[model samples]
Target: MNYIKHLNSVFELFTRDSRLNPTHISLYMALFQFWNINRFPEVFYINREEVMVMAKIGSKATYHRCLHRLHDWKYIRYLPSHNPYKGSQIQMLKFGTSSGSNTGPSSEQVEEQALVPYININKQNKNFNKHKLPKNENEVLDFFKKEKWPANEAKKFFNHYTSIGWKVGGKITILDWHSTAKNWMLKGEEIQKEKTLYGPSQKRDNLKIIKEKDYGQPL
Candidate 1:
């Protein structure tokens, strides 16, 4: 699906809708991410606790309230499974396509276009990871320092990732460390811009992540 167009359609329709509060928007976005990961599947089961964390909701009532509100407002169709084991099934209706029925893409479309999601765990000791990074911890620090990145930030990246074994989403391997660092620099700059644009009080969160690899082997 055309992601930008889809978002535009939602914005065009929902810009004036009073029902869409900040909390609702956050929950919808959380579901939207799952929809993307599931390859735009209309119907999929989800873990409640995981989703709540993903949405940054502290209470089940707040989470369910926004979820059902989205459903009742035709943003999604929710089939509640009171059975925790069964979990709840959610079907996100395509925006600006049709009325709130299950008019979704076929399995073939999903398989062909959607990215499969997976999880990984660090197998090393609690403070170390077995997976190797493309660059040494010191090398990464040097690169960031050379790139004019902050020293503390550089150390923060090294410490966090080395401890976690360079996994993403807990366990996924990062294929390109250089690209990740590039993105990190970009993100830092972006956050700096936001801070400047919005004023000093809008401080960005301080967190850095880095990973490790065996010495002298091809990265």
Candidate 2:
């Protein structure tokens, strides 16, 4: 049984009732941790000072007020003790109970239903930034057109990722395709530098070939 979800169900009701403040919620959660540790027993003891510390309640007045508020609201049943050595016993409502509804389940049903549903950390994050990223090569090329990237370099970037199924470093998915395009532009600068370095040498060789052909012709 998912006790956290059970607590969440109780909290849903609390959301409807605006009277429960953050302080009340904090104190309730502190009690909840104790209830969980003590294995959902019929009655759990509370150490007022310790609970105050756990809930970050600054004063005894606020602590007792919220504690009694929870009790009075039927969120928990409080049994007070006069003895300083003995702590008060609390039975938290582990399942459905309206503030004043007669439809509160029977004790047996309440015991069975007290244990409830699960909370999920759904894997929606994979698709979270997908929309913001380029969907295809055309979009990628168009995106780089306004930037400093050459068209061919943009195409190379697009094809590189497209061939590899749009993943980065073989495993991690690229969340931003534009960043990859920028990286392609940076790498292209290195290629352009190499071409520029050898460009004059190629021109010189071409000129020598033309001169040799002219010298052999009719001079």
Cα lDDT computed for each candidate against the true fold: 0.57, 0.59
Candidate 2 accuracy as lDDT: 0.59
Q: All candidates' TM-scores?
A: 0.45, 0.43
Candidate 1 per-residue C-alpha lDDT over 127-151 given as tens digits, one digit per residue, 9 for 90 to 100:
1322236566688878787778887
Output the TM-score of candidate 2: 0.43
> lDDT: which candidate is best?
2
Angstrom error at residue 3, model 2: 0.8
Model 2, span 94-143: residue lDDT tens: 65323333221222312111111121224233233343356677887787
Model 2: residues with Cα > 4 Å off, grouped in runs: 96-219
Give candidate 1 regions above 4 Å deviation: 98-219
